[model samples]
Target: MAGNSWILHRNSSVNFEKIGDSAHTMLIADASEPYEVFGSTTNWRDPELARNTGPQSFGNCFPGETFVLLADGRVIQVPLVENERWKLLRGREELRPDPLATQRPDTPWELGDRPYVPRPRQQSGNRNR
Candidate 1:
């Protein structure tokens, strides 16, 4: 059980832009301790890859859902669909055109097409002048 768990680390350098009410962003999902490996933006079901390669590897453990903790302190449970498994990757490559001249597979969900505007910063500091 513990061996299959992973820690989802948010990339502090990147600011998450909001769309509507939720922010669907990329997170670095790393396996714990002994299995400490880079698991983000990868296909967990790849035959040539190891089982500990990505968070999706433990999909069977949760039945049909994968839980995610948002930056706003909200936890979400996303369903694990066979065809949408790769959508969990959310790599930057999904935004820009692939330099390798390869075509990316089409997904049912909109990828990199959403208008994610950065949230306006609230004004703070001295105001009682």
Candidate 2:
């Protein structure tokens, strides 16, 4: 073990696996624990979440989406809300839309219909960059 990742998901199940060594790489769900989840094949490891980010990445995982864990302690069901952050972390071409669609950093949007957020601004000083 090289302190890489002792925990990983395979076939929609959670288990501890040492690094560099391949052991099945699959949970092989039991009869009691069905392998159906996340609107697709049973994949326990959250591809949407970046490594080491933890459950905080998912919107519904905490304070919002209800996080559900399997009885056998294998799978985790999180009602995720698609956002730009998630898409970028997906590491795929299917980029996810921005979390804040209304507000764009490049072209700021007004609190109502303008293109700038309503906030108190400070006067500029005599400084050349």
Q: What overall lDDT goes with each candidate model?
A: 0.31, 0.27
Expressed as tens digits, the lDDT of each residue in 1-129 for candidate 2 is: 001111222222222332122222212211111222223221233334432233212222132222322223444332335334233332322222233421213443333665433333233234553
Provide TM-scores for the models: 0.31, 0.18
RMSD of each: 19.0, 18.0
lDDT of 1 by residue, 28-121 (tens): 2222112212332222222112323343343323344445443445645655553253353343332322223222234322327763232332
Worst 10 residues of 1 by lDDT: 1-10
Best by TM-score: 1
Task: Note the residue pairs that clash in candidate 1.
Answer: none
Error of 1 at 1 (Å): 11
For model 2, what is the alpha-carbon lDDT of residue 67? 33
Candidate whose lDDT is highest: 1
Give the lDDT of residue 70 in candidate 1. Answer: 39
Where's the lowest-lDDT run of ten residues in candidate 2? 1-10
